[model samples]
Target chain A: MNWLTWRQHRAQFLFGAATLAVITLFLVPSGLGIWHTFRSTGLAGCLAVTGRDCGDLASTFSDRYTGLQFTIPLFMILPALLGVFWGAPLVAREIEQGTHRLAWTQGLTRLRWMSTKVVTLVLATLAGAAVFAFLLSWWSRPFVAASDNRFSFGVFDLRGIVPVAYALFALAAGVAAGALIRRTVAAMGATLGAYVAVRTGIELWARPHYEAARTISYSFFGSGPHPGSGDWVLSTRTVDRAGHLLGNGQSLDFNVLHARCPDLPGPSSGFVSKAPIQACIQRLGIHLQATYQPGNRYWLFQGIESAIFVGLALGLLAFAVWWVRRKVA
Target chain B: MTTPAALTATALGKRYRGHWGLRDCSLEIPAGRISALVGPNGAGKTTLLHLATGLLAPTAGTIETLGRTPGEDPDLLPRIGFMAQDVPLYRSFRVREMLEFGRRTNPGRWDAELAQGRMDRASIDLDQRAGTLSGGQRAQVALALALAKRPELLLLDEPLAALDPLARREFLKALMEGAVDGEVTVVLSSHLLTDLERVCDHLVVLSGGRTQVAGDIEGLLEAHRVLTGPRRDVDRIEGVAAVVQQATTDRQSTLLVRTDGPIIDPAWSVHRVDLEELVLGYLGQPNATALPAPRLARTGAEVSR
Candidate 1:
């Protein structure tokens, strides 16, 4: 059974191997060069030193290596590709060719067939996803450090174990869709759509709420309790004395000065300079409120997101098995 | 259940969407007999075969193969072989790979020697990709796979549809020759009444989601005879009034009757009915309630013979 599965999926395995080779070929030299430049140009030295500005070194390093950074973003669709090519075709091809009936009646029980085929493909997916994430994380170490921000959306998804989860979830969704639809191309399209919808939905709507975001409110003019660059600042608002949440922080002057400083002489003319408005806001004791997920919770968020996707993947897989056993005609 | 019949169904039915595909289907096929399941396009022959293979579950009642529930026991799968319509093969796989698939999946039960012998006789090369094979070649390969598994029961659905007349004759010969060597019970479904008549001794005719007629060919043929008698209703016969068809002219009546004993009416002249006429008669009138059922109720002992 295992041999049969391997023979059936040999092309997909070869494709995965070739992709891993290509990625390795491209990223290894580029990553080593980035690390070398970081050390050779004294950027690493400047960062380590306490009082050094590191501005020139940092800009020089960024200028030299920024072009290669765009290469990493191309792999953003790797999980989607796995879903379309490897996962969706797994069962749909069998059904389309009518080999599913052949296999099922070959004294190969449905349980063994599903376990051998689905498990091997999903395991391959896990390995491929893990390798890509590891390579990208290693390659992006310099960039992540220089910006002091790895918690951003695109960077966060590709740099940690969540990519592995995403790939597994995509593969499982593809297999499930293939089992249900029984047509290869349509199942691939559905898998792609579902993978994007679910991943982005969780990233956009549910990720921030994984943990209650801590908020810091400080006086408008005075910078206090500043959010770290690594922190994911979900929202920032400037409130007036009446406590209405302001839209954009740039319009802080319009929101505060007119509301609390009605007694000021500038009621007839808008102040072009910043001195009077700052003084008025300082006197009014207005504050800026910012909500953020702390930087230290990066691994914690990874764990939570990975758990959700893995759970979903398992559920989809179970549904697929049920469908194959009971519903397939 | 004295000695379990090779295949048994009790009020078996299958439904697709909202409509019944096979309804009130009940029959028993004895072991070691080559039975032909004949039906027209919408007669649920494929549905019944798939249900017996456990590929399609029943919507009502039950089906058992080899004295066990189909697909329920792990051990039962290896004992049964099925060739689906068009004899589906992994087109991407070489013929050798398909053989290997059968061998691996069946474990110790695969008869590699028999499979190779059949393949060689069919003139199919082991290295040829299944996609490149002709329809006749595909059927040969599929049959080899099923026979190679050394199953006690073999079910084939429309295996001859892919063959030319000559090839179908050869294929049926090969099937019987192969099945006879292993004492295998084979139930094959097809629309070719002529071909089945030549090869099969047992018969099952399906029409309107029901088993219109079923019995051993010799018994069915013996029970039914064309009777030419003075003009009268078929029910006026002195035995089981199982008239398949009745045609009356001004002075005489000719009717096909299936009965428990030979018609003894001296006013009647009786002639034998062939397999083709018998099959067509049942299939043509799907709504006929007076079934030619003398052979329909065969005892287990009678079937085992």
Candidate 2:
């Protein structure tokens, strides 16, 4: 079986490697440019707001670096096309060409012939996915680190471990579609459609929940000084000027403040004076904390998603195996 | 008589979408005998061949090759080489590659020298792509692939249908020479009666999904006769047991009669039918005993007997 598969796909494997090399050459310069841009701008303190330093420039770079996002997805698309154009035609072409009859009437069973093909293609798909994932991960690190926008989340979210899952899923889905459709063109189209839908669905609706759970916010304002204070008379409000909540802005009214600051002893005792407005105003600076952090959760989510997709891929692979085994031609 | 049967179909039947392709079509070919399956366009000859070779599953029957069911055992496949009608081959593969593929996949012991000899006799170039060959040349290649397996039984569907007379004769001569040792039993189907008569010893005639007549070629011809006379005198013919075919116009009548006795009628003339006439007579008859099966010897029976 291994020998047969190797004979069948040796051409495609060589072609795939050449294509990957060309893509890598193009990506290297682009990756270096991204790294230089990141170095020229400050690492942490770069202002990413108002489309000047942080918001618009960062968004434009993120969009330009969109090619990095496409690397894994594009690599994944190759296997599906292989399955459809090359792999799907594996059995059907034999039957269509009437070579299968000759082969089957020999000592080899139809099941064995199909099994060899699927196993070989699956291995190829994995190897391709692994190489692409490694290159994309290495290339897109600087850009991924620089961008803080939610849109950047979609592009680089599946970077480290998730692309593996995406690739496997795409491969399995392509093979299954090929088996079911039995035509090269139809199988390719179906595989692409299914991959796009599943990947898009996961990124848009399901991924944000992991990041939303871990955010924190804070705000502050200045207030007048108290007469009985020992050294300084000046005072300040901890909250913003309009009294709006900060750090991912959720409102912090009196009830919320009291609930959070229940152990503050007497508010007036904590302050120099017992003036309620002044004491309350002094403690008005806002702080909000969430349990889940986006970056940390991103890896966890990637790992979990990869596992789920891997399982789905296995299921699809099993179906493809079963389908090939039962194939009549 | 002690040797194993080369091919056997026991109550083999196949149906496609409620239409009968083959039904209760049972046959056995003893080793060394050249058997021919003669049928019309839709007589299910291809279906029967496919079933016998395990290319298709029988709807309700069994096919055995060398005492083992071909469908149940993959090992049996290599022992019986088959050439399907129109002989589809990979256009990209040269003759050498095609033969190499056959050698790689076939489990039986193949004689490379013997295959080369057969190819040489058929005048097929090893370097030419199968698609580039003429129709007759392609047929020769197909035959070469089957012969390479050195199979115990070879099933060919319309082996010479596309060949010119000269090529057909060459193919038959080569096939006869190849099977001279009586190790190979052949069951081939052909619409051309003369080709079957030249190479085949036994005959199985199928019409409308059933075996209409089957026997040694000589025996089939000996039992059937063609009678031509005036339309008014057709019923008056005497000493005839059965009429297999009858065509009546206003002026004259022609009848195909089957009988074991001598024809002595002065008013009617009886001519001994050839295998062609006999097969045509049976095929022409609407009610010519579906599966008019003849007794055949088991494997290793003498062809002359």
My TM-score estimates for the predictions, one after another, are 0.92, 0.76
In the order shown, the candidates' DockQ scores are 0.70, 0.35
How far residue B72's Cα lies from its native spot in candidate 2, in Å, is: 2.6
Give one digit per residue, the lDDT tens place, for model 2 in A201-279: 8766665454344333332332222111111111122334454543334443544445545644443555433354345
lDDT of 2 by residue, B159-265 (tens): 88888998888778777877775488899898778877877888888777666676667776776788777776455345665677788899787788766478787
The per-prediction i-RMS, to one decimal, reads: 1.0, 2.4
On residues A293-321, what C-alpha lDDT tens digit does candidate 1 reach at each position? 88888999999999999999999999998
Backbone clash pairs for candidate 1 read: none
Q: Residues B157-229, candidate 1, lDDT per residue (tens digit)? A: 9999879988897788779878988789999999888988888988988888888777779988887788887
TM-score of 1: 0.92
For model 1, how big is the CA root-mean-square deviation?
3.8
Give model 2's docking category.
acceptable
Candidate topping lDDT: 1
